[model samples]
Target: MNKEKWAIVTLSQDGVALAQRVAQQLDDKMCHIYTKEKYAKQNMQVFDTDITSFFRSIMDQYDIICGIMATGIVVRAIAPNLGHKSSDPGILVIDTKGDYVISLLSGHLGGANDAARLLAKRMDAQAVITTGTDVKGSMAVDVLAEKLNCVIADFTAAKDVTALILNNEAVALVNQENCELDGVVLPNNLELLETSRDLEEGKYAGVILTSMSRQKPEFAIPSVQLVPQKLVLGIGCRRDTPGEKIIAAVAATLAELQLNEKCIKAFATIALKQNEPGIEEACKQFKAKKVIIPDAMVQMVQSRFDGSDFVFKTTGLYAVSEPCGYIASSFGKCLLEKRKMNGITLSVWLPEK
Candidate 1:
């Protein structure tokens, strides 16, 4: 996964120094420093009138936001911007003296807890993590989904299932792929079931972790569908193609193959299409990375793929989608070789493990 951008919001001059210290320790490129116009330093951002507006403008751009101010003030400022655990940025708060690092919001999915731990070590401060899963030393399903590069199909259902795990209630993983857990420990009340029997009978509140779409009876179990990023679509669309059509075509292709849309890792394409609107739109909507494969790299792998005369004539490449997908996947196995629909051509690849 690409490293997410970071931002530091400091209310006082002392806080500004602390922010600069943090920027020096972590990635300077991804980090931003924000302050009120009155307290702004020479190289810092000065909020104009609305601090909330300034914060919101960078909310989606950054992965983690560290605020050096009073906890109550930071909370009120970010409360309105609170969103799903997966989509929201990690929120951290510390005093102007930088005495304590508090993991305030999106502790797991947005990495606030992890960021706190790191920054605490850097500053030799106490890291305050209060999540039930973390405090009790148990698995958090949302963290697991993120670590495994999966998507939660139903966020509301996930809330119910995670609540059970946190409460030490019976929960299970209806794992269809049987992928290795990599030593991931389950809570005392949770277990892994081989099939969906208990799920169908409403005997257990669990999670269904699979890339293939399954048709199951609506049962009493408060289960969530967790699908992994197992496939990447190498796509090339004609200029002016509507984003809806591009996204719909990808969806139709996945549906035809019985694959879950959530399993898509990214939209891989030639570097030439880096600014392609339809491709960019689809990727953003799906929460998939937009990977660009340079022409030289594409040329090296294009020979492995069969040439399409019409595609070469139109896109100036023998096989744009398949080669891009193959190269972007680090030469992973190709599942669906270049297939065309409307003005889009696409190929799917299983990402290298």
Candidate 2:
């Protein structure tokens, strides 16, 4: 994950000192301090523009906006730009005295709550979190996705399910494979069921874990499907293959197999092809990280895949895609078998659930 960009904004002279202190802790590079021209000091930028416009300008530029002012003032200025929690930046407010740190918006998905806690500790102030999930001691689906490094399917649905849990409504975790969560292998839900069938359809809320790309009708309940980063793609292409072809092949394969691109955490290819433009471009396009498998490891899994004799003689391995995919997945088996496209070969792997 990339480092979050933060902005420390001050409206009053008293708040300027506290803002600078927070900015100093956040570092000058990732965090910038902004203040009204009247209150601006050395090392901080002056807001020559309207205060509301200033917040509007940084809505998309910064990931977290910390305001040293009244919560109402900040809210009114930022209200117009506010959209969904999934897309908005974290909004936090602190008073001029720096006594309480308030998480004003996007408390979970955008990490305002987490940011407030850290900032409160640094400022020695109270962290005022009002999100229902925290108050009710309910499991937050978005936070779960963050911890597991997975993409959530149906963001709005996830929010609804979270609401149900926060309201003290019963929800069941259908532990199909005993999928371990952060090494807590034990079941934690009050109503644990072996399968989704155990739930009485729409009458109950449920959560299911899977690597498959979701279809809306898969679950009957107001539930969140967490697509675990279990699928990995191993790709190989002849030298000079255009990046477009490589990316298209991978995209089409995933679409056909109903696999979410977010679930594909890594892209792997033989070390020789690590610098290949096609492999590099495809991974970049999908925002997935890359893994270069050594020739020795590729050779180990080579016998498991069927390969073209010409590819074998040229690359020293019978196949690059299949072997590298397995190796990148920590030797996990392929969920989708090896496939050929033009000069490229692609295969998909999923860790054992």
Candidate 3:
């Protein structure tokens, strides 16, 4: 199921028509049509409260809010609720005639720009993107990070780097992971450094540093660290181990390894630990998928690694972390071998090459 919630808000009868059209172009399960009582139709939600109140109520509930009304109306309704760019929902405003789809708020990190462009194409309307980078036809730092599924370490640094790029200043890209730009065309002013060691101070106005480790090398110029979320964490905990302990253990392991928590994509464990509260809570807290490897699969991979008789007696498998991580990650290399902590053993897997 598409988990992203999209709210199509309309104020007038004509606006409702536009909203319905917008909803038709979006996933029906994810998109909702909301209008005033007089303008509401069957299967459409009616707002009994004032427009401002209604907008505020759904601000946190929806990932994208498309107001089928005047641009000024959306600005006024969402202004009070706006806090941070990364935290706020993407706000889009479309005219009643479907002439233009405006990317009003959270253009980059919130994905308003991309959403507006896609929606505009579907509705046969022009997309109005006002972001400096987009308007200038330059690559946006946040947009690149979003495409790579990376977490930006410093928003201020990202903004500074983006501004430098917009000003025609040279910026160095230290892509340690060889992170592909995919089909994105690079701005002429942005230069790619072969490695982090090639990032010389004062050579570029700003730098985009992409790496998995948090311990960054000291650089004189402003730099934005992009940590790709590509690692899978495999865990094996004793029966009845508390969730808090599992969480703490995982945190300590990441801290010791100088890895970002956002890099974890899944928490894999033996099938016996699938119902464990500690494993479930750890996955929930980290917002990672829970992968359960059956005992038979674990046995198949056990011969490749050292095993413990105690674990075999408990779970009918000699190894848990390594085998579970290996299977969960489609037989990827183990970056961190099993490390034991209070009643918990954990391992980290590298992303596929």
Candidate 3 segments whose C-alpha is farther than 4 A from its true place: 1-4, 27-29, 50-53, 238-243, 270-281, 284-287, 292-296, 303-319
* Of candidates 2 and 1, the better by lDDT: 1
Whole-structure CA lDDT of model 2: 0.78
RMSD of every prediction: 2.8, 4.4, 2.9
TM-score of 2: 0.76
| Ten residues in sequence with the least summed lDDT for candidate 1 | 208-217
The deviation in Å at residue 170 for candidate 2 is 1.2
Clash tally for model 1: 0
Which 10 consecutive positions of candidate 2 have the poorest summed lDDT?
A: 182-191
Q: What residue pairs are clashing in model 2?
A: none
For candidate 1, the C-alpha RMSD (Å) to the true structure equals 2.8
Model 3 lDDT per residue over 1-353, tens place: 55678999988988988887888887543888998788889899988987788888988888889999888888888888787886788999998999999999998988789889989999899999999999999987888887777778778888898889999999988888778777867899988887977866677988898888867667788788888878888889989999999999998999988888877889999878889998889988876889888888888888998899999898888999999998888999888999999889999998676
Best-performing candidate as measured by TM-score: 1
Sort by TM-score, best first: 1, 3, 2
Backbone clashes in model 3, listed as residue pairs: none
Model 2 CA RMSD to the hidden true structure, in angstroms: 4.4
Task: Write down the TM-score for model 3.
Answer: 0.87
Cα lDDT of model 1 by residue, 254-279, tens digit: 88887788788888998778898999
True-structure lDDT of candidate 3 = 0.86
